[model samples]
Target: MWEKNGIKKNKAQNYKCTDCKKQFQHEYLYWGADINIKRQIIKMLVHGSGVTDIAKVLSVSKGCVIRTLVKTGTQVNLKSSKKYYHKVQIDELHSFVGKKEKKVWTVRRAIIYAYDAETDEIIAVTAGKRSKKQVKDLFKRLNDLTIDWFCTDNWKAFKEVLPYERHLIGKQFTKTIEGVNTSLRNSCKRLNRRTTARAAPKFLKESL
Candidate 1:
């Protein structure tokens, strides 16, 4: 049994467990400090709620949401449900980070995504300069998959690394992956066009 101990500093009534002598309050003074807020943050993130939107809805600060996202990201590990991929589509999206991240007027980062064309599921993702090296790192993550074909745009970078016979060029081969762009932009505020929200450099990969 828990008995009333005293009034907490937040004015909420505090209680003490008789067996363990542990103390707790039914309500918290800081909303973000609650464990449930972390769960709600993830729930809002998947349900098309942005940082600002979640802050308002949960009465927490934007910093709290970002911190929770970073922490939650570390705990998540998504493994491939399948072993082989016959066809895959590769794409890059242009996104921005605040000037604080680079000390420039604005920095544009290319987020590369590799999708299994057969199932329309993401295989790997990387973010940084749109160079051959970036694509190389993205491919490294998919090295375990027995990929038979890769479909990408006429971007010169991919040609330098991927084999010629296994590569398919042009947007026509990327129909399934193209549809994902719309869904991502619709659900993520940072990816939405004409948005003021900018992510920090470290969060680029975690947010994806």
Candidate 2:
């Protein structure tokens, strides 16, 4: 697709599935995202572009981008399952669903992530409601790592789930992961508090 003003959009082409006798677009290498829209969406996400900007430039609907991100994004894992780290930090970021009514935000969700502090590499990331179970699940994933220190904020779940000796709770030691929290808010529209681009839990989870 290309615009009348000579602005090129996606170079995507379509094909039919031989077995299913169905047509599909080749841009996303999957269904839904057509005309190379997936590539554009990914690039926009990397550059910290908001969802509205991405949809406008790529010539796709906001809903289309969100659905595509959730479908394909969830299938790919960022962290290698076999790798382990030494020192790590854990933190949570917040996002909300729906709109504020009567001067109140509803359906709040938390985006929790872990990172290797020494290497400054992310280990794990997920989105869910703020609860003890969320913290437990995140810690459980890091069980494979050869962890020495686990730094976090003064969240009570961190104290309960993590080993007393290994867990380190203080702002000083958690600067790196804290910065990541800021970066997440800056990069993704759903993570921004004041933005109209809210997200459902499934979409937030995959987006993270």
Candidate 3:
């Protein structure tokens, strides 16, 4: 199935017959078209690499990096398992896009999710205000699954939404979810409000 096609005008080697007579290239003059590069992009995003950092490291353009992030983004799910988790941790990570006309801007942009403690897999996620609605919506995603109990910090939304008997409200049980928050904060530049705000005063101002 390996049939060689002549090099393109860009001087990149071309091949065919591997994908139903479709023209293919082992290497493309066009940057960021490689499967390996895309995989590395995902890996770097998970490991706390910013867009510019990924673009520089992978020798791709920033636009390509941003596009990859928008299309594939990052998957927080740790493992693929069909088994239901008995103990699930729910938590939120607070971050803001930019300063608002008033305070309480961070509340407008937050991420809440459910994480399986035993399997280390993210079960469900929701973005926006960390309110009862968002928390309820996050739980809705796992409605088909069997969840014995939930663990969360002293968030009023949890108290309102979750069953009192099936919920464990404490810092200890929520450690895993909290760790996820930290990792996301470290990985995603959008979550590092203070760092980006402080570091890029000029850029931030210009954007605003």
Among these predictions, the greatest lDDT belongs to 1
lDDT of model number 2 = 0.68
lDDT per residue as tens, model 2, 66-158: 665565544655564446566688888765444544222112346677887667677876656677888887887776767888889998988
TM-scores, each model vs. reference: 0.62, 0.63, 0.55
Clash list (residue pairs), candidate 3: 48-187
Q: How do these models rank on TM-score, best leading? A: 2, 1, 3
- In model 2, the worst 10-residue window by lDDT is 1-10
- Cα lDDT, model 3, residue 161: 90
Range of the 10 consecutive residues with the lowest summed lDDT in candidate 3: 100-109
Q: What C-alpha lDDT, on a 0 to 100 scale, does residue 129 get in candidate 1?
A: 70
**lDDT (0 to 1) per candidate:** 0.77, 0.68, 0.75
Which residue pairs overlap in candidate 2's backbone? none
Q: Global lDDT for candidate 3?
A: 0.75
lDDT of each residue in 108-142, candidate 1, tens digit only: 34678888766767878776677899899888888
RMSD of each: 9.8, 10.8, 7.3
Worst lDDT run of 10 residues, candidate 1, spans 99-108
